[model samples]
Target: MMSPIASLTLSISDNATPYYLQLREQILAAIREKRVSPEDKLPSSRSLANMLGVSRSVVTQTYDQLVAEGVLVSKPKRGIFIANTSLITMPLESLPEAKSAEPEKTVGYFDSSADHSVFPHKAWAASMRRAWLNPDPKILMGNYRLGFPQLKEQLAKFLYSLRGLECGAEQIIITAGNRDALQLLQHMLKKHVNQWYTENPTYPPINASLTGQLEHLDVQLGGALPPENTSPWAAVITPCRQYPLGISYSSQCREKWLQTLSEKQGFVIEDDYDNEFIFHGRPVTTLFQAAKHRVSAEERVFYVGSFSKTLFRGLRLSYVVVPKAFVKPVLESQKQLGQSASLPMQPALSDFMASGAFYRHLNKMRRHYRMKRDYLESLLNAHLSQWFEWEKPTAGMHILLRLKTPYADDPEISGFLKSYAMTQGLQLSLLEDHYVDPMLATKGIVLGFSNTSENDMECWVNVISQCLGCYFDG
Candidate 1:
């Protein structure tokens, strides 16, 4: 029988794509179209290269890649043949049109994300370079499962200087981000606790991550601690700056929670996200700090902090400071399940903190975000004041605007606004979605100003005004 290679037709063009890739695609297409069958022999690289009028290396490269992908098989001294395995059975004609290379344009996106334009790129790059050039032996060997010790040490100091919370480096476990930290905590505590509580109108992801029977503590009711009960439970609190509302837990409220948890043998996951972005006065006292002084035994507060808000969301680095008792078990859990946070960036982050670049970046962002918040507030006040009411947030990235007119079907109105905003390339979030029970949610909209520029904010505010006007007028 004639070799299958003689029957096959392959060609390449001098287009933008590389020669080897084009050849590879042609071979893949032939295989998918059933022009080649399994176990059919093909000519050697040199023979195929001569037939195709391309270099031998190009054929070799294409064959090697197809072999790696299991689309082709090589039997020693025999020849290359199509593998029995199928390649993406879907027909090429059915595939959707390719997306454009340029990103889609948006008028505004009011998201609680760090302003990438203001990131300290030069300093971060320098830190990354230093980390790679003089990497610690432990980091290279991947010995520390809990976290890189240098990063934990710097974070320990950072907590002390910023929040007056004292913790040993051994007690901190590095995580991918807030969700990772919460999932870890949930895994660790699920065996001991039967119930979990979170603030009503909390960060939606927090509710999604925690397991077991979950309940909400009403933030409108002062977010007080649950009644003194013997059953062990865990509550996730954003004391530094509550999500959506942007209100800090008062000192008295913090004390009550710590005292209740100490007595009830419960735990509190203190999500201290965005604590560094306090626009006005010093940051509020942390629940972790209060727990440290009050509870002598295993500290009841699990303090979770992330660089996503302060640095950039793409960094995917966060840490949870557990009690002294949890250090060993948490490390064991980390070893069993594998560390989720990327190890390579840990050393660079340690260097960034040590070289004072992290702090400098924080200071710069504080001023930048504060100015943005002020600008957004002014626009809202100037254009939408007649229809909306809001208290200017002293800290954090977002502002909650309550509609002055109470609608019987508030959620419908919120849904309408959100959908209309999307039509104009402006993303808007509904306050109702934050609550566990949508019926109890307040009538408001949440706007994040950190990532939106002043001009964009003004444009978005006007768009919101038009959306509301249309809703009421119609």
Candidate 2:
């Protein structure tokens, strides 16, 4: 019989992440969240292995690894119990050796994780150094399913100051990144939500994430927001700056979005992907504030913001401000998922934001990205104006050049150009590729201009133009 303490959820993926490591993360998360308390017994390795449908060896290895880390303790002829480590600062170098090999790093052609040239290495490192040296061991590892308290408090302030959104620290739940944020929401709300609505031409992976768990419904975007014939449980949208299209959602559009949520008492997952990148226009009214009169502030919107686009993707730090009602449920789901991001870095980042270093970094990057955006736009307009049509994006790291290709509906040319561009080491996303119905997908390639330096911009664009020239001028 499975013990009452054996309520561990282990979702095994047949990916590079080994099974033992996944088990370790789950147990650690449970401990940190206090879902499993100190002196509480854990299921025997044999029982856990059988429950999880894996080899008993896997569970034993995971338990042993945790024991070595001082996260768990064992008693002879008894069972494993959560360690009473009020604070744990086990040095990585002191841990038992693991069998996994370090993975190699690779850059994508469209990589926009961070501006490699301008990252505040010294500032970030200085903050982290202070956090690491703190005498409190809890800072090293505490179960913050909602996120480090310091980070949440600081982030709540940061969001209000920058985006004009208002919420308290309790409302903010930090996950590894947007992906984890969505997964946690899915885990918590799938029972209540039957369908998750998204924009038609959204990044494909956003829909891909909900596959199997819930149906993803794409509402075609155009001049006006469409009315929902049937109410959805919730909608995930990048309203401020719709992905790839670079168009901002109008007030009328926002009204419709709010209406759908109000009718169903559903929620909106607002992905503020390019929250700070707008080069023109006033900040779009946050979906949260827009819905305040119609519904309570917390019930209407789920504000999803990621440091990936704003700070650095590698940071894997993103925040979601849930409605007050959903806070406890989301945290419970996070505990079950055993999601633990780097604890030391969260507070360090919180300090970075509190000290205003984050804003400083953003100010610097905005100017840098603006200059890059201008250079890329100028190059494309000068050389390839006849072949493409596009608007200057008010904000974002990439611009979608809607191809005015002579062969309108033919995928052959667009497909060939995409394949050929790769040979020249140019990485880009086709706008058409993001659409659910291929016919509705627009023609053009999405260009991410953030990574290329000014000196390299002309060379890379010239090569890309020549690549397009072969197809167009042919």
Question: All candidates' lDDT scores?
Answer: 0.78, 0.72
TM-score of each: 0.78, 0.76
Candidate 1 C-alpha lDDT tens digits along 204-247: 98888777678778885355455455687788888778887877
Model 1 residue 222 CA deviation in Å: 2.6
Best by TM-score: 1
Number of the top-ranking candidate, with lDDT as the measure: 1
Which residue pairs does candidate 1 place in steric collision? none
lDDT of 2: 0.72
Question: Per-residue lDDT for 1-474 in model 2, tens only?
Answer: 224353555544434678899888777666555566667788777556533434567788999888887778998988888777753333444434456677744324644446767889899888877765762466433545577888899988888888888889999987766777787787888777766667777887788766454344553443225335465466777778788677777767777777766776566788887778767777887888677667553486888888877766556677888888888888788767665444546877887887788999999998889888898889988876877888887678987787775655566767787777667666557777887777766788787888767656676667667877777677
The deviation in Å at residue 37 for candidate 2 is 31
Q: Which lDDT value does model 1 have at 100? A: 32
